[model samples]
Target: MSEPTPQTPGTARDDRLAGKVAIVTGGGQGVGRGISLGLAESGAAVLLVGRTLHKLESVAEEIRAAGGTAECLAVDIITDGAPEAIIAAAVERLGGVDILVNNANMAMPLPLSDYPDDAFRTAFEGGPRVTFSLMKLARPELAKRGGGTIINLVTSAAVRWDAANYGVYSAVKEAIRALTRAAAYEWAAEGTRALNVAPHAHSPGLDWWMENNPEEAAAFVAGIPAGRVGDPLVDVGRPVAWLCSAEASYLSGATIPLDGGQSRWG
Candidate 1:
């Protein structure tokens, strides 16, 4: 199969979310970084919230360099009052929140039987707990904006049959999926849409796998009917950008798989 086309800088730029303010957790690296860039490129002032100040600054700088607005909020979202602080920062720094992207999560790869209590706690707090907190805190602001979009970054593993060692990971992700859908229904009257995106894109984790296990990585890539991993910015990010826009107003409480046909093919 031929390679997926590479996207050049500013090639697909548009003002789809212009004048809007978006809060993206873990916006410093991986898929979060790409989503931040995509949102900025589409004309939203992004508040990049994460633990690493430098990484957040770096992504924020890239947005500024591209003539997009962004701000860095370095904090551990798992901490108490962090959600409140994040919402406050977005309002103070970038105006009210019109979009909230719950994209940060940490789940160790372990079988359900072997998963320790500490590891499980870490995963639960970081994923579903934080996501729930942020969504609850941002609801009033999102509603105040007349309408808003909440994009929760879930995992395709939640739906895959052969979870194997991904048992604990999938459990937390599934919780996020449930929270998103529940919010979608509960907030329907308020014009706030909540949805999930399960993305299979190139990231540090995938790079580590490819470098350490080339054969396995190759077979994994081959399994994807698209013949390659999805691009973080173009494949995953662009669609997310569109999803947060008025064009997707009709969409809510749905999990969109950005896996290059891997979900269906499997």
Candidate 2:
């Protein structure tokens, strides 16, 4: 993919997210990277969190070069203390957290009966558990800022259930979908909104699948009404950026499908 186009200094479209701080897990690459850039471009100071220091730093540098504020932290979200540490870093580096994007996840495709127990456990630990922990940790920080938004990156497989060998992965994502809705409803009074974004984008995971199962990948792409898989930044990042902005203040407890009409769920 091409490098993200840099925005000119002092030419930001609008500072809807000005003065806000955001934490984007898995912000080193693919959809996470896109969201981080989109948020930064919209005038929010961003903290990019992921396991790879180099990848995170690269993305942070890109944001900085684009005249956006950003910082990078390398840490595994599944670790016991990671959530708290991420929130702390955001607070110390960017002032405070006004948006949280729980986009870090493991994509494992294994048949249900053949799936290893360890891998299944790892899936849940990495997906729902870590997301829950992060949301819980960031709640007070968001509240401190009067209000904020949380966007959980999910998959179309979780809702459609058409793909084989995705049982475990889909289940874990479904759990996150449930948690997102509950948080949206319960946290409404606290001014914190929660939602989900289901995107179909070109990423390393999709590349892997395409290389291993060319026929399946082709069929999947054929199903998209948009005639092509989405660009991570142009397609997925824009909607997520809007979700984190004040314009979407009234949107909560919903899942916005970014799959270009591939999935019927609204």
Candidate 3:
């Protein structure tokens, strides 16, 4: 595996993840992008996977510009072949995987009564199923390194269920939360740790909501005790990076709230 590039003058390098290899799905944008950059900054070779080739390329370029190593793969995670392909690519290019961030999610805001059956299936496919597939596929690679960390991006809505049109989304995310806990126990002997991170950040999806419904957006921000939405990288990504490091090796099966105290469940 390639080592992380040396940091430039006046730049500090946190080598907690030195020589580690990570795969971040949906890494082309929003929370995934933040986590991808954060892991790279911490000294991990990252494979950024997303459906949009251009977006993945852009994020990869940003990582390269920062003197960090990153490669982009554009693939739809909902496909049957995607998880295996992703793991194969990471192992081929970066050597082995030490971290897996399942951040790719598909959500459609609609009440249960009105939600289409196909949309509901797609939501589950994009959410928990994709996460499960990736984790299983990456298991051997992680075990090869003695052990590794898996972070699945969940949401506060999974617990709160307060949002009017998010029933399907919440259900799917909650399923992933359960899977994360189960994986933590089942994969422990193999040296893999599984955890969930529920974040409330200013993501691109939220940005779109803010643009379409200003009143709801204002109310959402006002509800947070932090008095503002969290930055994707500053608030969410750093914590995720820490979770993947040796300092947090003892942690597993926990759903950490990265939502500025907005989530009722920790």
* Per-model TM-score on C-alpha atoms: 0.96, 0.92, 0.93
* Regions of model 2 farther than 4 Å from truth: 1-12, 161-163, 211-213
Model 3 regions lying over 4 Å from their true place: 1-12, 161-163
Candidate 1, 1-266: lDDT as tens digits: 24567665463289999999999998998899989999998999999999999999999899999899999999999898999999999999888999999989888778889999998999999999999999999999999989799999988776676779998998899899999999999998999999999999878887787879988888788988888888889888788999999999999999999998888422
> What lDDT score is found at residue 120 in candidate 1?
97
For each candidate, the alpha-carbon lDDT, in order, equals 0.90, 0.86, 0.86
| Candidate 3 local Cα displacement, residue 193, angstroms | 0.8
Instruction: Write candidate 3's Cα lDDT for 1-266 as tens digits.
Output: 11123222222159899899999999998889888888887889999999999999998888788788998899998887999999999999999999999999887778889998888889999988888888888898999999999999888886674778878888888899999999999999988999999887767778888889988877777777776776777777777889999899899999999887777984
What lDDT tens digits, residue by residue, belong to model 2 across residues 61-91? 8888878899989998888898889999999
Q: Worst ten-residue run, lDDT, model 2?
A: 1-10
Model 3 local distance difference test score: 0.86
Among the numbered candidates, top lDDT falls to 1
